[model samples]
Target: MKRNPRDIIVRPIITEKTVAMQQDDNKVTFEVAKGTNKIEIRQAIEEIFNVKVSKINVVTVLPKKKRVGRYEGKTKGYRKAIVKLAEGSTIDLL
Candidate 1:
């Protein structure tokens, strides 16, 4: 399936750990659309960033339960992709 890059890649996850991973491992973390696979993610990222992708790792972020007094709800769960860029490739996610 041909999916738009913007639709596949929801947003960059710019937490401290991701920052460290980017700097140390040359990988970028992103919150990707649910039900997307590595090939789709690789295509989207490459097209959007114009960089070559080496490898991709995906993980499902399980929803967490939250409660306020008697009321309770579950946080939204999403898919995360860690994309490793080719040598000398970098993405300015800012």
Candidate 2:
């Protein structure tokens, strides 16, 4: 099934590591829909952000068990994509 660009990319991941990568490696990180693939992520980013994507890497975060007081549960799992942009291109996340 084809997904909308906006629907495929959940949000930009803003973190110390991601920020560092953006500055040094011309790359950006995003939290994306779990069912989305690398190709979808690449297209979504290129279309929505208007940046040329050079490469895409996807990673899945497994849920971890946590205990709060008397309750024991697992945190929600999610997928993240690391998109490397063309050398001369950039995305103004701000």
Candidate 3:
């Protein structure tokens, strides 16, 4: 099935560690839909950023527990993808 560009990519991760990665120049990562596969992720990034994707690595994170005054809950789990572009390719996400 053809995937919508917007559906392929959920959002770019903006955190302390992800920010550091941009500075170090190793790998760029993003929060993606749970059902998105490696091929979909590569195509999405290439189409949106106009860059070649070398490889992709995915990680699944489990939900974490949360507590309120007298209640407890768990945060939603999410999937993250670490996309590696070709050596000379660069994405100016900053």
TM-score of every prediction relative to native: 0.95, 0.93, 0.90
- Number of the top-ranking candidate, with lDDT as the measure: 1
Error of 2 at 28 (Å): 0.3
| Superposition TM-score, candidate 3 onto the true structure | 0.90
User: Which stretches of model 3 miss by more than 4 angstroms?
Assistant: none
Best by TM-score: 1
Candidate 3, residues 1-94, lDDT tens digits: the string is 7988788788888788887876686578898998888988999899998988888999998999999988999999999998878888887777
Candidate 2: 10-residue stretch with minimal lDDT: 85-94
Rank order (by lDDT, best first)? 1, 2, 3
- Report the C-alpha lDDT of model 1 over 1-94, residue by residue, as the tens digit: 5889999999999999999999999999999999899999999999998999999999999999999999999999989999999999999876
Weakest ten-residue segment in model 3 by summed lDDT: 18-27
Candidates sorted on TM-score, descending: 1, 2, 3
Taking all chains together, the TM-score of candidate 1 against the true structure is 0.95
Alpha-carbon lDDT, every model? 0.95, 0.91, 0.86
TM-score-better candidate, 1 vs 3: 1
